[model samples]
Target: MLRYVTVSKNSLHDITLVALIHDIKFNLIKLLQ
Candidate 1:
């Protein structure tokens, strides 16, 4: 159970990071336009 929780937490962290990167990319594109 502990391992499962840890894995889920890691996945959530990765998702958040991806989301942040995506947002940054989107803003950069907007600025370029």
Candidate 2:
């Protein structure tokens, strides 16, 4: 049960990191344009 909780937390963190990177890339593209 504890292990499952940890795995979920890790996945959530990864999702947020991916979202942040995506936002940064979007902003960079807009700036370039």
Candidate 3:
């Protein structure tokens, strides 16, 4: 059960990181345009 909790946490962190990177890229593209 504890392992499952940690795995979920890691996945959540990865999702957030990807989302942040995506947002940054989008903002940069808008700025360039």
Which residue ranges in model 1 land beyond 4 Å of their true spot?
none
lDDT of 2: 1.00
How many backbone collisions does model 1 have? 0
How do all models score by TM-score? Answer: 0.97, 0.97, 0.99
Please give, for residues 1-33, the per-residue lDDT of candidate 3 as tens digits.
999999999999999999999999999999999
Provide the clashing-pair count of each candidate structure: 0, 0, 0
Estimate the lDDT of model 1: 1.00
Error of 1 at 20 (Å): 0.3
Candidate maximizing TM-score: 3
Q: Clashing residue pairs, candidate 1?
A: none
Per residue, candidate 1 scores C-alpha lDDT tens digits across 1-33 of 999999999999999999999999999999999
RMSD of each: 0.2, 0.2, 0.2
lDDT tens string, model 2, 1-33?
999999999999999999999999999999999
Superposition TM-score, candidate 1 onto the true structure: 0.97
Model 2 regions more than 4 Å off: none
Question: What lDDT would each prediction earn against the true structure?
Answer: 1.00, 1.00, 1.00
